[model samples]
Target: MTAISVQNMNVWFGTGALRADAVLDVSFDVNEGEIFGLVGESGSGKSTILRAMVGLVPTWSGTMQIAGETLGKKRSQAFFGNVQMVFQDPYASLHPRHTVDRVLSEVMRLHGIADVDERIVQLLDDVGLGAGFRFRYPHQLSGGQRQRVAIARALAPKPTILLLDEPTSALDVSVQAEILNLLADLQQSQGLTYIMVSHDLGVVGHLCKRIAVMKDGEFVEVLSVEAMRRLEASHAYTKHLLASSIQSVS
Candidate 1:
C-alpha cells in the first residue's frame, strides 16, 4: 500500500513580487510499513514539504495523495485520522498548561473516541512513559520525556502514517539513541509508514530503508542505506552534505 505520493510538487510563499519558492517540482513515494527518510541541510525545504502534505501550505501547486485520497480536496475525517505529525520541538508542540492526559484526551475527544483513559495509558506505556507521569504538565518532564509525550500524543490518534520532523534533534546523544530505538520498536510493532525529515544521515541510515536528499527545494539523490555506506559518487550537493554531516557526527 502506498501511503503518500507527491508528484511535480511545487511550493512558494507570498504572492506577486514577494513570492519565494520553497519546494520546486519535488516528488517522492512512501510505501506502507516502510520508513522513507528525507535529508537535507538547513533551508532545504524539508519541513515545507511536510507542511504541504498535511494541507498547512495550501497555496502550493502539485498532486499529493495520502492513502489513495488526494490531499487539499479531501477534507474527510478519515483522511485526518490516518495521518499524524510529530513536530521538531517537543516544548513548543505541547501546551504548557495542559497535562499529558489532557493533551492525549483532547485528540481522542475530537475524534469521538470514548473511554480513552485505557488507550492513552497504553500509548504512554508504549512510548516508555509511565502511568505516574500521565497527569504531569510539560514543564515537569525532561526533554526526552516531553518528546515521549509528543510521540504518545501522535500515536494516541492511531495513525497509519507518521510524519516526523527531526524527532530527536534537540536531545543529547544518549537520549537520541534511546528515542531512535523507541521509534524503531514502535514502527516494527505497529507496522507504520514513516516520513522522517532530518539533516542527520546517521539517524537516517539507522532507521530508514531509503533516503532522499534534497537540495535547493528539489531531491537531487535517492539512495539506499548500503549505497550511502559505500560512499559512491552522487550529486555534488549530496556529496558535500554527506561529508559535512559525517564531520558533524564525528
Candidate 2:
C-alpha cells in the first residue's frame, strides 16, 4: 500500500520576472510502514517536497495523496490528524513558555480526545522520558532531551505518516545514534510510514530502504543501498557527497 504518492510536483516562489523554481516535476511513492529517504544538499528542494505533501507549500502544482485521499492547501480535519511533522530544530519547534505536559495536552484537547492522561504517560515512556519530566519547561531539558520531547509531541496524535526533516542534525554523534535507534524501534513497533528529508547519507543508509538523491530541484538519482555503495567516480557529485559523509564518520 502506498501511503503517499506525488506526481509532477513543482513549487515556484515568484511569477513572471522573479519566478524561481524550488522543486520541479518531483514524483515518488512512499510505501506503507517503509522509510523513504529524500537526500540532498541545502536548497535542493527536499524540504519543499515534504511541505508540498503536507499541503504547506500551496503554490505547488501537482498531485499529492496521503492515505488514499488527495491533499491541498488548507487540508480537511481528517488530513490534519493523519499526517504530522517533526522539524529539524527542536529548539524552535517547541514552545518556550509551555510545560511539556501543557504542550502535549493542547493537541489532545484540540482534537477533543477524552481520557488522555494515560495516553500521555504512555507516550512519555515510549519516547524514553519518565513521567517526572512531563512538568518541565523546554529550557529545563538538554538538546537531546528536548528533541525527544518534540518526537513525543509528534507521536501524541498517533499519526500514521511522519515527515522528519533532518530530525537528528542538531544532536551530538552519540545522541544521534540513540535517536536513530529509537526511531527505528518505534517504526517497527507501530508500523509507521516515514518520509525523511536529510543530507546525511549514513543516516539514510541506516534507516531508509530506498533513497532519492536530489540536485538542482530534481531527483538526479534513485537507487538502493547496494547500488549506492557500488557507485564509481563517474558520478562526480554523488561520489563527493558519499566520500565526505564517510569521512565525517571516520
Candidate 3:
C-alpha cells in the first residue's frame, strides 16, 4: 500500500521575473510502514517538498495523495490528524512558554481526544521521557530531551505518517542514534510510515530502506540501501554524494 504518492509536483516561489522553481516535476511513492528518505545538500529542494506536502508553501502544482486520498493546497483538520511534521530544530518548533504537559495536551485538545492526562504521560513515556519532565519548560531541558518532547508532541495526535525534517541534525552523534532508534521502535510498534529529509547520507542510510537523491530541484536518483552500500549509483551526482558521505565518515 502506498502511504504517500506525489505526482509531477512543482513548487515555485516569487512572482513574474522574480519567480524561481524550488521543486520541479518531482514524484515518488512511499510504502505503508516504510521509511523513505530524501537526501541532498542545502537548497536542493528536499525540505521544500516536505513543506509543500503540508501546505506550507502554497504555490505548488500537481497531485499529492496521503493514504490514497488526494491532498489539496489547503489541508483540512482531518488531514492534519493523519499526517504530522517534526522539524529540524526542536527548540524553535516547540513553544517556549508552554510546559511539556501543556504542549502535549494542546494537541490532544485540538483533536478532541479524551483522557488527556493519561495520554500525555503515555506519550512522554513512549518517547523515553518520564512523567517528571512534564511540567518543565523548554529551557530547562537539554537538546536531546527537548527533541524527545517534540517527538512526543508529534505522536500526541496519533498520526499515521510523520514528516521528519533533519530530525537529529541538531543533536550529538550519540543522541542522534538514540532518537533514530526511538523512531525505528515507534514505527514498528505503531505501524507508522515516515518521509524523512536530511543532508546526512549516513543518517539516511541508517534509517531508510530506500532513498531519493535530490539535486537542484529534481530527483537525480532513487536507489535502495543495498545499491547505495555497493556504490552502484547510476547518476554522477549520486556518486559524488556517496563519495562525500564516505569521506565524512572515514
Candidate 4:
C-alpha cells in the first residue's frame, strides 16, 4: 500500500517579485511501513518537504497525497492525528518548563486519545525512557533522553507516520546509535511508516532502503542505499556527495 504519494510539488517563499522556490517539481511514493530517506546538503530543500507534509510550510503548490487523502492548503484534524514530526533539535522541540509527563499528556489530550495516564507510561517505555523520567523537566534530561521524550510525545497519539528531520544529528555521537536503534525497534513493534530527512548519507543508508538526493531544491536522483554505498550514481552531484561521504568516514 502507498502511504505517501507526491507529484509535481513546488514549495516557495514570498510571492511575485520576491518569490523563491525551496522545492520544485519533486515526486515520490512511499510504501506503508517503509522508511524513506531524503538526503542533501543544507539549503537543498530537504526539510521543506517534511514541513509541507505536516502543514507548517503552507505556501506549497502541486499534489501531496498522504495516507490516501489529498492534501490542501489546510490540513484536517484527522490529518494530524495520523502523522507527527520529530524535529532535529530535541532541546528546542520540547517546552523548557514542561515535564515529560505533561508533554505526552497534552499531546494525547489534543488528539482526543483516552487513558492518557496509562498511555504516557507505555509511550515512555516504548521510547526506552521507562517511567522514572516521566516527571523530569526538559532541562533536567540529557540530549538523548530529551529526544526519547520527544519521540514519546509524538507517539502518544499513536500516529502511523512519523516525519523525522535529522532526529539524531543534534545528539552526541555515542548517543546517536542508541536512538537509531530505538527507532528501529519501535518501527518494527508498531509497524510505523517513516520519512526521515538527513544530510548524513550514512545515517540514511543505515535506516532507509531508498533515498532521494536533492540539490538546489530539486531531486537530482532517487536510488537504493546499495547504489549509494557502491558510489554508483547517474548524477554528478550524487557522485560528489557519495565520494564526500566516503572521505568523511575515511
Candidate 5:
C-alpha cells in the first residue's frame, strides 16, 4: 500500500512578475514503511515538497495524498496525529523553557491521548532517554540528546509517517550515526514510513533504498542506493552531485 502520493506538485512564492517557484511539477509515491530521500543543495526545492505535504506552504498547487487522505489548504486534526515532522536543528525546534516532560505532555494533551504519564515515560525510553532527563530543559542536554528529545516529541503523537528535513545535519559526526541507527530501529519497530530530505547521500543511503535528485525546483532523476554507490547516474547534475559527495569525504 502507498503511504504517500504526490502528483504534479508545485510550490511558489510571490505573485505575477515577482513570483518564484520553489518546487515545480514534482511527483512521487512512497510505499508503506519505505524511506524516500530527496537530495540537493540549498534553494533546490528539496525541503519545499515536505513543507507542502505538511501544509506549511499555503501557496502550493497539486494533489497530495498522505496517510490515505487527500490534502486541502488546511490539514485535519487526524492528519497531524498520523504524521509528524522532525526538523534539522533540535535546539531550535524545541522550546528552551519547556522541560522534557512538559513538552511531551503538551503534545499528548493536544492529541487527546490517555495516560500521559505512562506514555511520556515510554516515549522517553523509546528515544533512548533515561528517567532522570525527563524534567530537564533543552539547554541542559547535549546536541545528540536534544535531537533524541525532538524525536521523542515527534513520536509523542504516535505518528505512522515522519517528515525528516536533514534530521542529523546539525549534530556532530560522532553522534550522527547513533541517531541514524536509532531512526532505523524505530522505523522497523513501529512500521513507520519516512520522507527524508538531505544533502548527504551517505546518510540518505543508510536509511533510504531510493532517492530523487532535485535541481532548480525539478527532479533530475530518481535512482536506487545501489546505483548511487556504483556512481551510476543518468544526468550530468546528478553526476556532479555524486562526485561532490565523494570528494568531500576523500
Candidate 6:
C-alpha cells in the first residue's frame, strides 16, 4: 500500500519579479511501513518537499495523496491527525515554557482523547523518556532527551505517518545512534511509515530501504539503498554525492 504519493510537485517562493523555485517537478511514492529517504545538501529542496506535504509551504502545484486519499490545498484537522512532523531541532521545535507533561497533554486534548494523564505518561514511555521527564522543562533535559520529548509529542496524536527533518543532525554522535534506533523500533512496533530528509548519506543508508538524491530543487536520481552502499549510482550527480559520502567516512 502506498502511504504517500506525490506527482509533479512544485514549490515556489516569492512573487513575479522575485520568484524562485524551491522544488520542481518532483514525484515519488512511499510505501506503507517503509522508511523513504530524501538526501541532499542544504537548499537542495529536501526539506521543502516535507514542508509542502504538511501545507507549511502553500505555494505549491501538484497532486499529493496520503493513504490513497487526495490531499487538498487546505488540509483538514483529520489530515493533520494522520500525519505529523518531528523537526531537526528539538530545543527549537518544543515550547520552552511548556513542561513535557503539558506538551503531550495538549496534543491529546486537541485530538479529543480522554484520560490525558495516562496517555501522556504512555506517550513519554513510548518514546523512551518514561514518566520521570514529565514535569521537566526543555532546559532541564539534554539534547537527546529533548528530542525524545519531541518524538513523544509527535506521536501523542497517534499519527500513522511521520515526517522527520534531520532528526538527529543536532545530537551528539552517540546520541544520534540512540535516536535512530528508537525511530526504527517505533516504526516496527507502531507499523508507521516515515519520510526522512537528511544530507547524511550514511544515516539514510542505515535507515532507508530506498532513497532519492535531490539537487537544485529536483531529484537527480532515485535508487535502492543497496545501490548507494555499493556506490553504483548511475547519475553523475549521484555518483558525486556517493564519492563525497565515502570520503567523509574515510
Q: Residue by residue across 1-250, what tens digits does model 6's lDDT show?
A: 9999999999999999899999999999999999999999999999999999988998999999996668887777878889999999987999999999988898888988898998888888888888999999999999999999999989988899999999999999999999999999999999999999999999999999999999999999999998887888999999998898899999
lDDT against true structure, model 4: 0.93
lDDT, each prediction: 0.89, 0.88, 0.94, 0.93, 0.94, 0.93
For residue 51, what is the lDDT in candidate 1? 84
Model 3 residue 88 CA deviation in Å: 0.2
Worst 10 residues of 1 by lDDT: 71-80
Measured with C-alpha atoms, the lDDT of residue 141 in candidate 1 is: 97
Error of 5 at 249 (Å): 1.8
- Per-residue CA lDDT of candidate 3, range 1-250, in tens? 9989999999999999999999999999999999999999999999999999888899999999986679875677878888899999987998999999999999999998999999988898899999999999999999999999999998998999999999999999999999999999999999999999999999999999999999999999999999999999999999999999999899
Write the residue-wise lDDT of candidate 4 on 123-186 in tens digits: 8888888999989999999999999998888888888999999999999878999999999999
Q: For model 5, how big is the CA root-mean-square deviation?
A: 0.8
Q: Who is ahead in lDDT, 3 or 6? A: 3
lDDT string, candidate 2, 124-172, tens digits: 9999998999899999998889999999888887889999999999999
Give per-model TM-scores. 0.97, 0.95, 0.98, 0.98, 0.98, 0.98
In the range 105-163, model 1's lDDT, one tens digit per residue, is 99988877777989988988999987989999999999999999999888877899999
* Model 1 misplaced stretches (Cα beyond 4 Å): none
Could you list the CA RMSD of all candidates, in the order they appear? 1.1, 1.5, 0.8, 0.7, 0.8, 0.8
* Per-residue lDDT value at 124 in model 2: 93
